[model samples]
Target: MTIAEAPPRLAAAADASLRWYPGGPYDLARTLGPLLRGNSDPSFSVQGGVIWNAFTTAEGPATVRFNPAGGAGLEPWVDVQAWGPGAGAAIESVPRLLGAQDDWHGFDEPAFHATLPRMVREARRRSLALRLPSSGRVVDQLLPIILEQKVTVIEARRAYRYLLHRYGSPAPQAGSLAPAGLVLAPTAAQWLQVPSWEWHRAGVGPQRSATVMRALRSAVALERLAGLPALEAATKMQAIPGIGIWTAAEVVQRTHGCPDSISVGDYHLAAYVGAALTGQRTDDAGMLRLLAPWQGHRQRVVRMIQSSGFRKPTFGPRMTIQDHRRH
Candidate 1:
């Protein structure tokens, strides 16, 4: 299914401030772009007119489309010209998730507001800034975080792309914004059915793959966990066998904009936060102390720091990519 042209109103929304998709809102596909682009390991094969990684911006509910009129592959599928509620209401909510609304604008505390500007300015000199976009669905966002546990990003992304392409379905349409080889992510049932060899083929080792299967088996229970507070959600996610503090924090931060969910186990986050906040590199405890002043809004502050343009020096050896497929 292809949309020939993005309806006129959606074009206007794109003109305003929405950065991710100028066309409209994508439900689950929104998460895919970040996963693919953030880490190079999930390199999608962009063959055919199907720009599989493109996010669909419909006037109503979010969906993954092939070529829904607006040009084939990555042209940005959108439908915003309609005036009625069905799709239109969904379109309006897009801005809220993107933080386009003014009410959601302010940082939680005034003290944070005061300190962040300096940080932003400092970051500006270095050409870095923190950015946060509402990633729909806690489960979708949490998956990669879970896969990345105690491993390199390259390893995690490789595992993700392989899993999705092999087990996920093809988008209803041929070639659109969805990844060329990817359709929707594996459903809970599908996840449970995957064979052990397929996991190995996807470069996901046994441990992470098994954890994913367990989570998928309980997908319904996990989806219900969405509305919980970030901390609470983090706790629930951690209860899973392979998931841990760092992964849960990583997932919650993007899933709900949780203010205090600093990524404690990230390979580079603590150092990055340390150098960004203070001139020197620090460990997890030090990073927490630095962010303590903005306790309730810690995630927000980290977003600011990232957006502020600070860069952690990178002289150390990068983590080598390990292809579990060979194992």
Candidate 2:
């Protein structure tokens, strides 16, 4: 598509200070430029100036072609899309959350930009998206993230890949499945219909499976939670029995892009922050203490540190993945 003409669909924040490029698998580097780093997904493809892919969400089907350097007069890419109804809204919000809307806070800004180069290199190496994806609703997002909770990264990625390959739908486009065998994850309604045997086959245990089912029961309401205040939305999410602080924070950090949601219970975050700031491993309390100065943007600071290259020692034995089916 020609860069001179603005895409038929585009989203800008209330202040016009921020704009977004839509379509699936948006270009974080081209869209947000130097502000945010992108972790490439080897599964997607690039043709011409667009990255084409389909994102399967609970809201029917959406096929997106992401064109970087989009929008009118702006050299940097803004999100552009054609068919997805909620796509514009989700894409628009990401830039604002990435600080494309407001100038950075003094305390947080100093730390965020100060440590940014290191963070970008580190995030690129690890593929961490500080601004996570919000395709349509996040209830479905919670399921896959919960699958990774308290587990090794390899195990989590394996489980996600297996489940999607087995249960999800192929792209609506005839052969756009890409890189051979990639399938989108099962939607919320589809998740509800999964057989008990399939859950076992996918290596999901009773607790995690039950949590997904419990959340799916109110999927519509969960999507509506997007409009609630961050803490209130998180509280509503936590009320779902199995959804706890970490899970809720993880979901909201993307859905609301709440500046302060530090994911209080993450496995490596506390120690990562502790070692980065004080040169020693620290727990939740220490993480809070170190991050207290950047109260409004604690998560942003943590994001910067995480993007920094310093890694905590991984000497401890990895968490073992148990096949509950055998139990």
Candidate 3:
């Protein structure tokens, strides 16, 4: 069924509460697992069986809670609840957010399937319920990804935590989700007003902070990219200064659920894919050549390979954590 045909109860309720059952195989945890930065992500909290995510939509700040409604099964449904001014929009987004629009039926091809190792094939079979979540919001994903540029995960996450704590508003129903505070991301205006000192305190360097400001200045145009296809959306995003292929790939993976957008400049992805598939280290070009056959489903293939628990041999020094704040 189309999005327009979604349950009337969902759109009608401004308070935003609805029960949804995905007709096909679905795993809420596996599908949305990547969206969460880590268990410590201040914007998201998973407790017991429920996942709570707080974000600022065009309408306003909102908090969404996803609870499993049925017993453990391949096709279990979820009971969704939303709060705050953007509740209606958030509720309307449930279907896409839960991956209702991801079409993976034609994803697995003969050549790609034939190339997979037994372990990877088995992993793929077990994760058939996993789907790519589409947030349909650019700024929500873009800012954090920009913060991640040229920084360690720990540094990036620290900056995100600090910025949200300092500038974000409290999520309306965050108390129910966790005892700790859950906050929505800062709005465009708020992001623009953040002092350079604050950015430094948050461990964000001048370069990354400037990048965010540039995107915020064009926030309206950037948000419009959500309606575009993944490639086009990436292209539009790359037009901004400091936003490159890696940043664009990261953004579309969450915003559009683009399965083909690969992180071309990743430090370890090419090596990992190369080591797993060819038992050798490969650069981005080699990785692209290897993944050519699985063009449309390249990210899906990468995720499967990652889930297969294969790791590349570490032969060199790791990237050291840098503290720009001190500088």
Candidate 4:
């Protein structure tokens, strides 16, 4: 919000020094928040007012650090630095990674907010700092999400950290400037090489491991989906076995910034949506029916209301997480 209306474009000086602006109410953390699995996540980091992201580009591995710069009443601007062979590609991805490519027009309109629940309306007023970033890296988004299928968040985060740390190599060119011991996620070949025993050690059961292996076999096709429309990309993803509506939607949410993609099979999402809307719990059908009024911006609606901190009362006991490694 502190940024000027006509943000400056990065000069063609140095690829590694690329920088751009979101030109609106952009909050760096909010834009990239969903990509982080946990503090132990190898790919992302935030410290000392800077954010570092290590990822694989088609060219190779790279570490990107982005910072929002503002002081002395000056309008805030973004600063970016990169390291690796893929640094140029990583630099080019800055815009989409900060949601410069996103279109949240209708969702921001006051008229639209007038038709929503009071909590959601209030959330929208405060949520201008958020954006749904499209990372445009399909395999990068898909790997951890596949491991997350039908599992508790604790289970999923554990498995993701284990597998990533074990298979991923040290990120290239991340010196003292980058996060200490930062790691890049494994390449498709490295992922294919992971043994079943290692998967067991990571607490990924046979079914989930098989699904990941199957999806990796189509890595080329999946990577190509970034160029397609979000809905069509989701449909193509569903054609793969073990990738249902939930997984496909989740993938497109990151890779395509698909605003309408809802995690229909999620354990808590439907209840959360229901609670935010009417202060009463509801099933997936009811959530869908309630969200139907804003079919195109459903995910935007979810983000806003959930950001409002209004949710169904939690009186029930927590479900015990299954330890798949023991099986």
The CA-based lDDT of model 1 is what?
0.56
Give the range of the ten consecutive residues with the poorest summed lDDT in model 1.
54-63
Estimate TM-scores for all models: 0.70, 0.72, 0.91, 0.93
Q: Could you tell me the lDDT of residue 76 within candidate 2?
A: 47
Tens digits of lDDT, candidate 1, 171-200: 333222334443455556667888889878
Residue-level lDDT tens digits of model 2 in 165-268: 67776644422322344244566788899887777777777788888889999888898897787778888888888889998887776666566787887877
1-327 in candidate 4: lDDT tens per residue?
A: 222212234323223755466666667877787888887798888896688888989888888888787646655567887788898888778778888877878876778767876776788877887888899999989989999898888899999898888888887765555677788999888899999999998888899999999999999999999999999999999888999999999999999888899999998898888877888889999999989989898988887776666657884666678887788
| CA-lDDT, candidates in order | 0.56, 0.57, 0.82, 0.82
The clash count of every prediction, one per candidate, is 35, 9, 0, 1
Q: What is the lDDT of candidate 4?
A: 0.82
Better of 2 and 4 by lDDT: 4
| Residue-level lDDT tens digits of model 3 in 1-327 | 323222575434436777777776667877887788767788888887789898877788788888765556544678787878898888889889998888776666676577767656776887777878899988888998999998888899988988888898788764433446887888888889999899998889999999999999999999999999999999989999999999999899888888899999998889888887778889999999988877798887787677556778995788889998888
- RMSD to the native, candidate 4? 3.2
Candidate 1 or 3, higher TM-score?
Answer: 3
Top TM-score hit: 4
**Which of the two, 3 or 4, has more TM-score?**
4
